[model samples]
Target: MGSDGTTAEVRCVAAVPCWVSLMAHDLDVAKAFYGPLLGWEFEPGPDRFGPYVHAVTGGEAVAGLGAASGGWGMPVAWTSYFGTESADAAADAVRERGATLAVGPLSFDAGRVAFAADPAGAVFGIWEGPLGRARRLDLLGAPVWIELRTPDPFAAALFYGEVFRWDGRDPERFEVRWEHDRVVLRAEGHSVAALAREQAGGPAGLPPHWEVSFAVEDTDAALIRAEELGGTALGPAFDSPYGRVARLQDREGGRFAVISAKP
Candidate 1:
């Protein structure tokens, strides 16, 4: 059970977000920019997907990058994938909740995978394999957190709760604090992700989306490298309870965050 009286029984059944992938119009430009900025080394994906590239850090696959093609009209951005016991079941649950399946419950050598968009239009994926689980976070270039910024935090929470079996009770359950805009999702008392309502007059031009944050040794230094690599800093680095954080956009305008957490 969870600490706040909500059941944690679903922790074993529902998959946590274990990987993130960035979709880019130009794969070469994406590689050139991220290779230096994040210290990511890329290798070709499995035989099924020829254009896919897996981002490796310290010899382990941490993320993925692939070309955006076909009728994929969304802007270039990172898509977070949750590990699931069965991608087909997860896809059914997403559809039952009124969310649209953007991709497939397609089979691969690694496992099954699918992409879906929430009712608010935030895209995410489901992965079923040992390779789909979250990698160790001891390295500086690993993802530490994922967040959803939507117009309706409450609705987003409810939607994810239904799909992922997350505890979404109101007032006292599953919140870091009642007044906090960010609602944290926990699995066995450990936070896995969060949903935040987009603030009025703040980056409203960007559509509802998921932002993946990678941990760094120094936020200031990382921000500098980002700028040097043709990326733009969305804002100056600032201290938070979690760490020093700054928002950044890739040269192609895909947004992400970097944080140097307090130890």
Candidate 2:
């Protein structure tokens, strides 16, 4: 199991494809938020239902985007799902770790998926790709980055280390790393992962949730669009060493990011 009690192998898988399943409160509003912000083009679902967002990077369908309806927690934020080879096996590993099963490893018409909460309380998705996934590492773009914030960095590392068996760089920033890449659960400041872990932890703290981000040409303009779209700005826009950032939440209560960075 992963350190948080999900599939360690799945979590550790390198080059795991990322796909965002947006559960938006208002589809039209979300379209407005992303269309101009990310320059995405809308297309039919092929067989999926409603409209599927075609994420373009140099004008290619690198990923799929779609609005989620229902669920009281639905909001206009991006939710990240990692690609796995076997949903059932991954789910089994997660269960073995004493994790909470929120949804299915069950079959969807399109694919197989399951939802679970880690020991840190961050909720994540596991997807078994029946067909395929996207083709990009795609930094400096929409929601291309992820950061983990955990209370017990060592515990977090131990959990994840067991799951993915990933090993990597000695972080200049975080404590431990997977494949020497991202410092697993070792961030000191505020980060999307930290925020999610806090949220997932609950009332006294923040709930763990994915903070989906969008590519914006102007952070101020994106914040303006956020207000117009019935999405609220969670905090002031700040400049990260990496870039400029603003936090946001939509009507249904999903949180995400809008970032503008220097070229």
Residue range 8-70, candidate 2, lDDT tens digits: 111212223255666565666666665655666554332234444445444444335565443
Badly placed stretches (over 4 Å) of model 2 are: 1-17, 46-57, 62-77, 108-110, 130-141, 165-205
lDDT of 1: 0.73
Residues 12-81 of candidate 1 have per-residue lDDT tens digits of: 1144677788888788989999888778887766535535677767766677788855656667789888
* Cα RMSD, model 1: 7.6
Clashes of each: 0, 18
Worst 10 residues of 2 by lDDT: 6-15
Q: Ten-residue segment with the worst summed lDDT in candidate 1?
A: 4-13
Q: Which candidate should be chosen as best, given lDDT against the real structure?
A: 1
How big is the positional error of residue 68 in model 2, measured in Å on the Cα after superposition? 5.3
Q: CA lDDT of each candidate?
A: 0.73, 0.53
Measured against the true structure, the TM-scores of the candidates, in listed sequence, are 0.82, 0.68
